[model samples]
Target: MSGPGPARPRLLGCDFSSTPSRRKPIVLAWGRCEGNTVMLEALERFPTLSAWTGRLAQVPAWIGGFDFPFGLPREFVIAQGWPLDWAGCMATYTALGRAELRERFVAFCAARPVGGKFAHRAADRPAGSSPSMKWVNPPVAWMMHAGVPGLLAAGAWLPGQGGVVGAPRVALEAYPGLVARDLLGARSYKSDERAKQTPQRQAARVELLHRLGAGEGRLGLRLQAPDALGQVFVDDASGDALDAALCLMLAAWGEARAESEGPGFGLPARMDPLEGWIVGA
Candidate 1:
């Protein structure tokens, strides 16, 4: 009698690259969530950050999970004497060149003791994510710099951190590794290096896909991908496509929560707006 209810909004998951190029583009998984199933529609590649930003702006409505830090640790911000508010802090942060940002972060770390060099967001421990300020070994600091500005400029709502009120397009910070580790548990499922793409890793990918399809995680959502698309997810040695797919699942999970939980998108109510919480953390 309800006649299937309203259609779900389009969902997206982004596997971002700080410096996107043709060889290592930003990978996006476009999909929709229906009941407990997250259906994959396509995988898009953006050869440059500008192209990616343009695509984000063009989409009329979407809930996107982006695999990048949207904010830095509050401790790091305070120690560096940066502004305490999200907008001011981000403005100061984005004004600096990558070289300068790295220099400041390095200096801040050098003042601290070994094993406690990097300051972490509260979300980091629960999400098992690297500190947002780390300049290398992933360079997520660069990711925040390159990625968050575009989200802000595109008028995508960032939940707790400031954004256009009631904006149709929503962006949430997401880390696919959290979902992967939940199912795989310390198993490495993907690698960018050719030599590291062993049969073992490939097997891990197969297992992850299977688990996701079966709705085996806390999110309680199954992944439905076309047979050919599923093969593409597994065959890409880099794991970019697969990671994007993981983010898509997280976005769907958040969207499901939004219907009941309001604008927090499943994030904690008391979360510090200065350091954004990862969705589902």
Candidate 2:
């Protein structure tokens, strides 16, 4: 077909861990998009954030969907007297130790009402992601602390936040739960604990994979994985592989938006730069 169509850009979906170890490393799903199809090529694991950052810096070009909040709530920033802009805010936030960050967050929550303890960014509601300030439960606040600084260090361009001019790798804040909810619909599909990995969750994961391959959501991109890889996704009770695959699809969608809509990576034009919007939210 005319010497084959133009090659698709490499895509990455990260299922990040705030504290990665050999047993629960950050998982990266590598793939490429062809037209409306996103194909998974491989999954890579990094036991440390440094190793992951190094890998990101070496990739020649990619649009990665990273499963972590890229920015904190503007309210939180202002209240803490941190810098208002994305770059300064991230720099100031990352400079503090995890314990110091937790202490500040806990104090902030203690001052507020029980139900409204956490401040939220604009993207949280639409994306159905947890408040970026939460330190416990899912500990996404720690994830942001651990992840975004590395993205900056690696020189990846964050679309709405701050972009590095001429940067080859593009990083978007992605939440696989958004896509997973669309396919699974409040159904539980994964668990980190062995005791929680029930047959019901396993069946839910199978159904989610089936629906994703059939292109069942608003993104309208089908997923294609080798049989063995597909098996890996289904068999992993931790759901890290499946989450990474979902991120890949989101990254592909962001890439398509970049091509058609030009910069901002399909994020709202008026979105607060200090609180970056989740791509495809």
Candidate 3:
């Protein structure tokens, strides 16, 4: 990690995958923020959720912005008769096996009319994110099912959920797409297929890094990195590296907001813990 600065905790940004594997690992970008600069010091990948959680348990202090849904929509929870509070809802939601959960979610969606099959969290519309209840397409529901429990198990403080003041490691919800779109609009930046990973996408990544380094875009924090490291962000066709960097910058922005505005780290004061807010939304 980079050297500490401003007495603030180190920053982390994670791009998560449900059912993480060696082929599509969960990527974590970690660094430090100094003044207006967010320096990305390292990138790590974990092949499994357990490995990621175990690594998190060892960190002494950090403020992380993870690319996963922190909670389900309140409407869905209420309709399903789940607990209303965040902790209780998570407990009730996580108890079921994935198969059972999928079955129930599928049924719920099937019963709804077209264009409204999935219920949405308040943050979804604002962040332009997928509905947390959708099991297919992105499988973000499963990501939530797999990811949040690990944060809880690792004893990381979840803002607006159950975080205590001065908690060693604070975890917040973040969306890299928000930052990416803010800067690059709808330009494609990544592809999982080798054939589809064209030079244009690589160029998009390069342009993104350049702009981010130059402190252009919504987060208002510059990315500080060596030239070679900037190349590293572009060479990966999966776009995981650049996405992680975007998330890291968002973390820095959140820290700045917390320092200026009160606590809550750029999240809205009225955010619902049951349906967590996106960090920069």
Go through the candidates in order and give each one's C-alpha lDDT: 0.93, 0.91, 0.87
Q: What are the TM-scores, per candidate, against the unseen true structure?
A: 0.97, 0.96, 0.94
Per-residue lDDT of model 2, residues 136-174, tens digit only: 889999999999988888988997678685587899999
For all candidates, the clash counts are 0, 0, 0
Which residue segments of model 3 deviate by more than 4 Å?
A: 1-7, 163-166
Any residue pairs clashing in model 3, and if so which?
A: none
Candidate 2 lands at a TM-score of: 0.96
Instruction: Answer with 2 or 3, whichever has the higher TM-score.
Output: 2
**Against the true structure, candidate 3 has what lDDT?**
0.87
**Per-residue lDDT tens digits of candidate 3, residues 53-162?**
99888887888888889899898898899989998999888898889888888888889999899889999998999999888877888898999899888888887887
Residue 246 lDDT (model 1): 96
Indicate the TM-score of model 1: 0.97
lDDT of 1 at 258: 93
Superposed by TM-score, candidate 2 places the C-alpha of residue 173 at a distance from the truth, in angstroms, of: 0.3
lDDT: the better of candidates 2 and 3: 2
User: What's the true lDDT of residue 93 in model 1?
Assistant: 97
Residue-wise C-alpha lDDT for candidate 1, range 1-281, written one tens digit per residue:
55786455689999999999999999999999889999999999999999999999998889999999989999999988999999999999999999898889989999999999999999999999999999898889999999999998788999999777678889999999999999999999999899999999999999999999999988899999999999997898789999999999999989989988787889999999999999999
